[model samples]
Target chain A: MPTIDILLPGFGLDTDQGYPAFCGVFLVRGPDAAGQPRNILVDAAHVGRRPFLWTALADHGLSADDIDTVVLTHAHWDHVQNIDLFPGATLVVHPDERRYAHTPHANDWATPAWTGLLLEQLPVREVGDGEEIIPGVEVLGLPGHSPGSIGLVVHTEAGRATITGDALHFAYVATTGRNPLVFWDADQAARSIGRILDVSDVIYPGHDRPFRLTADGGIDYLAPFALTVTGAGPDTPGLRFADSSARPSWVMPGIQEQRALYEKNADDSARRISRVPRVVRPAAAPRAAGPGSG
Target chain B: MPTIDILLPGFGLDTDQGYPAFCGVFLVRGPDAAGQPRNILVDAAHVGRRPFLWTALADHGLSADDIDTVVLTHAHWDHVQNIDLFPGATLVVHPDERRYAHTPHANDWATPAWTGLLLEQLPVREVGDGEEIIPGVEVLGLPGHSPGSIGLVVHTEAGRATITGDALHFAYVATTGRNPLVFWDADQAARSIGRILDVSDVIYPGHDRPFRLTADGGIDYLAPFALTVTGAGPDTPGLRFADSSARPSWVMPGIQEQRALYEKNADDSARRISRVPRVVRPAAAPRAAGPGSG
Candidate 1:
């Protein structure tokens, strides 16, 4: 049976606010055709975070070279920057996405510099919609966010788990069916979201924590820190592990609220650091006035 | 000097209503590297209309093999079905469009059957946005009607002419800035239309006939049958060849009006045929009376 591990728990309190809100990277471990264990990486994070990604791999007793294959969900900067880290890995992307990467629209987040880098560095294998990348892993073309976004479906003992990169940005976006502000086609985005919801038992969102579909047609938010499933019962719909006392509802904060939360957290951290006393040697600096200071 | 000929004048009174309304194919005659005349076909028409297209080519003293290059604006079924007719031609398409042709969205007009045919048969050379396909021909990626739709800019003796395939469905849509009912992204379509207006003195629309942009930022409708510049002046802003007496306004009829016009035309054609004397069959013989009727 194949197993999945979260190298970084995507976009939550754990990630920096300035960077892309992504679910970092996921590593799938399974036996290859020769029955030897192989590791496949889902997406590489932002450019500056390569060291952190490497450390995470080291923590799992694996190195960059151990990554035999890397499947790109889309060609967005944050999701594809660290592709060069895995030198021996075979790169896979949707054919449409591969083309989009080369000539993205001006309004899109893609940059020519990044596109140039990708063309110069990576040898990519283009895959079609619903095609299997590996024996247990298949791709679903979900266009909207970009021209050629895709979702990965993995068959595991836990059932079908779909790694949706920006296709479903957060649980709130999926459950409430609110179109993301940044998208190529709103109608197509909505349709792709509906399609993803129909097939997957568990969904790993691009920017938020994972969630599972309950048997009774509701969602159960999985715990961010732990990989174990949490609050997964037919009776407990929309349950988040962080707050077990209250039933979960779609609670995506607005931009203002997010900024306020960041500011408040920064203030709190500053206050905690204020408790340490400073050295009293500052008083001597007042005697060194210049001639003009008279 | 290079010249252009309309192989099929897309959608008009001549085209079948049930089929695609498109400015079917264009032949641009220019000197090749060796200073010999060569023909570049802009797009290929629908599947079953090969004979009509062949006859049109023959009328112009050319054959399918005379087309040294076939430049696809997009991979829509109506625009790419007859590519096999010009086997010797080099196929040029936007990189984004080629990718899009491979993995089109379900809601889009792209069909898998057509896409499969294109992929299996065509050896495409992908060009980037603003990249030159030939010495005097440049590609502009216009993403709106489709994710990877493009326009061809040709520097001719008359002026800069843009072959816009579905980017500007009609001159009215372009001048009024009203998006066509069918489009991938309305905003992008509008922007692309504006961009096309800025660059080209004359535009060859995909569906409607060619129109020239006046210096005062108005459109002058070109005569479809004559292929001669009609009403080309800054004073005549909205000029339609259909009615030379009055300036043209947006004349896209509503569904009811269109249906009524079709019905009326069908009735008129039937009436004209009925005018031909029919063979007066002597009263059907008495032997035709059934025993029950008797």
Candidate 2:
């Protein structure tokens, strides 16, 4: 059987505090009974520590040609920057994501390579909810932040480890019972996070380092790390992980409950806001005015 | 001062449709001052019309190399399939759209080329809401279907024509004031349509043919084409363009009124719903019978 090596590509620092944000690259290699190696690279960095992905692959003495498949956790620039860099690698992503690529006025950050023009020329294969890309890796559809956002689960020798993607941006998101304000659908994200916790023992967030779920159901992190503001006040620092117990709440039921509460409230609030108004209020109306003016 | 010609590209329909969707394309010829004869292709086809664009260009005795600038009104798949086909052309788009391309799971109809991957590889330049790319063309930010959506206003001999992208998918969208349910934000789409109406006399929809906004504030067809829904329920024939007047009150004013109503009631309704109980009443639960329960 061919050996499988999971690679951590590089680390980037949050511009505000200079704390590091890890850029992760996963390399999956193993053989069927036929004994041929199947190689895959999942989610390359668009922001901090981006260069390390290329360097990490080089360090493994593998070129871009060595990667046969690339799976994107989501379409965020941070997660997909190195996509085009993979050259001819066949990209596997959700079908909803395919439509997202076409909507105009959508954001793509400032990176030049992350444009519609490049994706047009690149090779891509569309997958949908609950589908398996390979033997051990399964795609989970988690829409909210965007219609096609997804999480990936890998059944490993140790157990099942799931990459939560943007379903949970940081560990604290699950711990404090606070849903980060920056999301497309707060309710959908909450549901997705709940589903994620039910399925996996460990979670790797899109923005933060890997962490473990604690017995008390909390995300327990060992070391200090950079965090995202996420429309929450800046004081909430995203934590870094070192080992199995490093980030604990991910495995804890207590943390899961908190996340559930936050998700439910936040989502309801957003949906309420999106509906059309029954009465029109004048521009100068007071904030606490009763309904039915305009 | 380059000579420019606007050529419409071919359509991009699948075998399921049997024939290609004859979506329109426009070619812009650089003004007489430059004398170099620069050609621009706008809004490629969604189907069999691929060769149509090429043939139109060749009929004018020009090749792809003569093309210098390519701009899209928006990032729908039908409008942007063959973007890479224009190799050296400097692709101009709204900067906000660049970010939109990277947003996952939204606007699932776009081809990957219209998203981050294309932006990454192409020598693309970003334009702002009111920025001008060429002497006769100006950008107008129009958001609703997608966050970074934009329209292009071209000042020409034919009068000021605005390519509305998907802001007005059909003439009725503007006349009836009815925005589609598929929009990310229907209110935003309505506002954008209103803005586009204020700026130009001629309007071009993403689908269907072009039309002229009449002086009496009504939508009038510039050509003799009608909208037909092929796959709707059998009992009801889909709505047609010819059956309605230029002013569609239901879509336009009714929409505005609905928006007002929803906004007025949103907060109170939200608070009420939030206070509701999550559990259901159970018949089998130990109930107090007339004063005493066993």
Candidate 3:
């Protein structure tokens, strides 16, 4: 098997399984007999300490300008945010995506209200169901959570490896085979799962620790971390400094424990801490009696 | 002191602590010397389950159409979501607010994306600073969070009660005069707080419990379960919803506990729950990587 130097940049955890785990982006590089290397960011962490994505690449002597292309699996926020940061790279996306983002009222369960903002900013190219994004990378439309969402199949000697976006988020989903039905179309999500089971020896979910598939039709979604690319080729060696001074992405910390704490303590601190995002507020005004007074 | 009916509709613990809380609307009614009944909805709940500001009145056998006027505290999401729900109800907002919401880049923190959406749906009449919104109600430009955010001053026999909007979110803010400059323009927010303290004897904040200023200069915030609107005229009864369905506000249960649980356990739970609003599946492919990626 050839060596791919995969770099793992920073990511955020939605639900803390235990400690603060991370989502990762991988920079894949391997030397041919001629000693030339290929560079690709397998999956990028869309949220969290995002500047680190650029910094790490610059650290390794790579910058956005050096990248040839980006092969994306799905368009979830955590995986799609930094795409705009790389305005010069050719973006390879499933053809079905452009329509989804532009829908005045997105009907997809997985869509966010702000998703449109990202689409309006970048230059993207759409690929089809079976097209190869590049040599050794085949695009497979894995329509489950989304109609156009796809996964990338990287043909390697070790085995056919898959970047299975949210098609299979965690090992638990694969092991239990229990689909959460949170996808916009459950039938599509299920079909994608089936496609994933048939193609690769490994699965890289959008939000979870990656895992390998077992011979017995089970999945082992428990890998510690994967590597992603951030830097230019071997010519550069130092990382670039991104804007770290920006406001910290408001990560809701200890939401699960906060709920438990509130159950036990029910104090002011407990009340103040929660995992849910804040919505609207109402005035703390008293009720009116009739119209005359004021 | 005259008896006034006060209804404590449900609201947020976090976002409400800021300016949008000032966007509350309400119905102000006491009684004429002749005992004729009057009523109105001060600020309508923007949207969602808790149509409290409107439905609460309905539960009391009065419909929103019967309320005559829907007074807006400010034009923020939380205070403005349900403004359209009252079709025939007159929407009275400050003149500056109408202009601000219409301006391009009204303020640095202004959310212009949704401004056009709101304008298309509301029937609004603008009032100037210090202009009388009604016979007993007055609009005062408290501009701190935004250029046109206002506070509502209601004249009652109990002296003067000011609805500080985001002006003074907590009674403590008015008394100690300290602001928790988390997510807004600190300078403007501070100015709004100062102005609120200078006028009203009692400060009603958007978040914390509301309380009156004592002769000793102390402050008190009320607890949700402890608040009740007491005054009612002979012809007008205090607003009380005997039907729970009338209060369709969305309140996440065990959230404080959820936060505490996440903190205490800091375990696998954090990896499980998604706090961000889900994106619609099939967004446009991310734009090509920029020159920066190279």
**Candidate achieving the largest lDDT:** 1
Indicate which candidate wins on TM-score: 3
Docking class of 3: incorrect
TM-score of chain A of each: 0.71, 0.65, 0.63
Worst 10 residues of 1 chain B by lDDT: B12-21
- TM-score per prediction, in order, is 0.38, 0.39, 0.47
lDDT of residue A22 for candidate 1: 36
Better of 2 and 3 by lDDT: 2
lDDT of 3 by residue, A106-203 (tens): 22323333443444334557887778655666778887565467877777676677776666655556655434433345666777788887897766
Cα deviation at A197, candidate 3, in Å, is 3.3
| True-structure Cα RMSD, model 3 | 22.2
Give the clashing pairs for model 1: A10-A23, B10-B22, B10-B23, B23-B206
TM-score of 3: 0.47
TM-score of chain B of 2: 0.65
Interface DockQ per candidate = 0.01, 0.02, 0.02
Off by over 4 Å in 3: A1-92, A104-118, A134-137, A154-161, A213-294, B1-186, B199-294
lDDT score at residue B12, model 2, on the 0-100 scale: 17
